[model samples]
Target: MGEPSAPGTPRGDRLHHPQLTTLVDTARFHAAHSPQVTAVVCEDRALTYARLHRESNRVAHAIRATGAAPGARVAYLGKESEHYYEILFGCAKSETVLVPINWRLTAPEVSHILQDSGSDLLFLEDEFGPVLDRLPTAPPKTVVRLAEGTGPAAWTAGHPDTDPALSPTPDTPVAQLYTSGTTGLPKGVVLAHRSFFAVRDALAGAGLDWIDWRAGDIALVGIPGFHVGGLWWATQNFNAGVTVASMRAFAPREAIDLIRDKGVTTACVVPAMLRMMLGEPGVEPDDFTTLRKIVYGGSPISEALLEESLALFGSEFAQIYGLTETGNTAVCLPPADHIPGHPRMKAAGHPYPGIGSKVIDGEGKELPTGAVGEICLATPAHMVEYWALPGKTAETLVDGWIHTGDAGYVDDDGYVFIQDRIKDAILVAGENVYPAEIENALERHPGVAEAVIVGAPDERWGEKVHAFVVPVAGREPSPRDLHRFLVDRLAAFKLPAAYEFIAHVPRNPSGKILRRALRDRFWNDADRKVN
Candidate 1:
């Protein structure tokens, strides 16, 4: 990692606080100001700020009854719901770290996280009970359902509405988000309340209005809450005391309906979701009249699709750039830069206020302007560390700077441009999917001897997973055969889009796979570029 670059335009602004403010205090603050305002809304439930604050206290008291110590892990396995936020705030009040698992992961993958976190208690959706049964080792923690009248709900009802008033410091961790490990195992990226809250305070304190949180925004949350991007977006809205219209998952038609019916004014979506919405039935430019801004990230957007969306939604488009380790987004392409034919359209915009970044060469020296190098950024939003992986943490977070494993360059104007991913992790439809994980799953098949996974350029999703397979001695594996084998073993998004049969998988002399060589075959066009 490189040393911090001089604070540029946005960085000149100073942080306002001497210490991090607890998220529990944030809830209390909102309740005091907007007691009757809608805070969280799901299918048929809308929780007011006062109710949300009181209920979270009850949840915290109930969780305390479970014998969970401070900083103990409390895991949730399910889709987005009011219950999710309840559990989130409840954990915050109890000083417990919340671990939101990716429900799309296979049973083994889920079990690995559960085992690693050693979570004291798990409050999961009833639908996920079968998945838990598929775990190789029975999880030893207490499991409760996240439903009304369940054991957990009954316990919460028995607790007082008064606050526990547990004192938690700014350094206290809030969540542990697991990133798909490039080496075939997932590693937890631990974030504190300061990781998200402090950054927002600093930006607003500096008069950064690109993400100005305003009341009556009516935000639509279509991103999966398991990822840091989704979680931070939702929290940003709540921090501003805005009404949040939550979605269980992103469905094109459902999003359109929410914008039209719920009068949603803003949303945090991915490029693929924008593409999917264009094809949804009955969608027209006027359908999104209520929407003012659409902030998208996780994958790059094609110029053609951006043009279509610009005309259709008639809403300002902003691009965000960051990773799990940086608390979702450290840089943003403001609405002013979204102009047609603008040069900064491809730029990731300047570093957020108070964010420090540098483009550095392999020697750890800052590169000259326009020189492609690894992007290193430091900010209040940066995660504290990789959970329990001190060695990996030391390698990634060097001297308080997070070495983003992305190759990029900074222009003289201070705009950053992302060129490629240095790490072999593939982003599929905004979700990080590593090739090694897919290859490991493929090798388990009897008909497959060896496999190499690569990302191919895709119009909808920024990249699609492509597999090159070499069959075992006498078995020739067809695409259908391999697809059938992986259907239940992996998430649908991680399934290979195309398969090529070869005699052997390519590797270097040292027995390491030359993934770039294999990946280059599908990305030969000069026109192919990602933000």
Candidate 2:
């Protein structure tokens, strides 16, 4: 944490507020300081700071009325909305953990999360009632229906709108966000109240604006709240006492219009969402005039797409890199390093002021600079553990550092350059080929909009690289053309052996490419079993 300013000073008074350590304190502080400020707006509903605080208080009372004790799990299955934020703070005020499940999951997936979390109560939107009916077993101990205008239920409305007056420390568990499960079963990453405010505290009076919050800035929460990125972004803005406009679900055309109509000054999204917004018809630079900065992450982006987006959006772009375990971002490629063709454009930026990062070999020894190894990060915002998986938690969280399974190297200047997931490397004739390297090269082509690389089981060699390409609108490049373009860049062994052109690549809600889905088609046909 950064050093505190002198007492009695404005900065000191603002940064050292006694009521800013937990989510409960945050809601109270903002409501007391700016009661009439619009805290959150979703669709046609808006909540002022005063209303959010009072409504969440009623929700806390309602939660206790259901016999849910402190520290119990409260699950919410719904899209992004003002109601979601209300439930989140309600869970906070009641000293319960909030589990926001991915609404896009199927019935089995939803059931698995509900069962695994041992939730005491559930709050679900009416839109997913069918999923609830298909559950193999009974629902949680208590289930409440959430509608657009009903707001939790009429019973909750009858509860008192006064603070529960419960006190939770900064280390109290407040949120449990699940992993995307691209590699295997999703593990719940439990984050405490401190996770949401670590970066903000680190930036206090540091004279850095790498990611800053200002008054009158309306942030757009395009990503869903189930993802840590979206949840963290919204909370950070709220902690700064700024208004946020959240979408029920992301629609590119609707998002563009919201930016224009709401005068949104800051936004967060993944690279895939940016592509979709740019692809929308009749979108012009003027449509995004209100945006001052745009934060992007969740997957590696090609230089071609970044340059195009920078030109169209005309906003400062900052790239973030991290996993759900690290509370969203441990490294940020700031707007200053966003030059189109600069070498540092490919580098993941330096760690935040208080965060620590390093690369270590399989033997747990620190590696020299520029040597690829598993990237590990030590941050105050690191998760407490994987829910009910002590062994997995120990394997991942080592000595206060989280072993991020990603392979990367640090330069002399401390810029981290990610290669790919260590397990995703493809082996051909004893040579290693990283899918991201090939995908970056393919996306550099003018005709390619996006590309994904996956490894397929082979009889001759252990594995071969296969490419899935999404062409730009009105342009189609054949395999021969791609091969000719890449012949001089990548070695013959690293080149893809086959190509499959598709309309769009499959991605999770967080915008990570589903490499396993593409690779499974080949392995299933070849009778080669893989995890």
Best by lDDT: 1
Clashing pairs in 1: none
Give the per-residue lDDT of model 1 (tens digit) for 1-531. Answer: 222232223433322332337778768878887889999888767889998888889989988888998989988888887778888989999999999999998888888888888896888887788888898877747887765323245658879988889877767898999988888888999998877686577566666656655657899887889999899989888877788888888889988988998899999999999999999887898899999889899986777888999999998887888999998898888777777677777787677767877888888998888889898988778888888899999988988788998889888767788887788778888888888888999999999999999888877788899999999988887899999999877878889999999887778899887888988877777443342
Error of 1 at 176 (Å): 0.8
* lDDT scores of the candidates, listed in order: 0.82, 0.81
Model 1 bad stretches (over 4 Å): 1-20, 148-152, 527-531
Q: How close is candidate 2 to the true structure, as a TM-score?
A: 0.79
TM-score of each: 0.94, 0.79
lDDT of 1 at 501: 91
| TM-score for candidate 1 | 0.94
CA deviation > 4 Å runs, candidate 2: 1-19, 181-183, 423-531
For residues 1-531, what per-residue lDDT tens digits would candidate 2 score against the true structure?
111121111233232233487889989999999999999987777889999999899999999888888888999998888888889999999999999987876665678789988997999899988889988777998888887555674758789999999999989999998763333356788999989888777656444566778888899997789888899999988888889998988899999999999899999987767888889999999999989989877664567788889889999888877767888888888788888889887776777767888899999999988898888988888999999989889988999898887788888777778765655766553333567767877888999999988887654344688999999998889999999988755547668999999999999999987888887787665322321
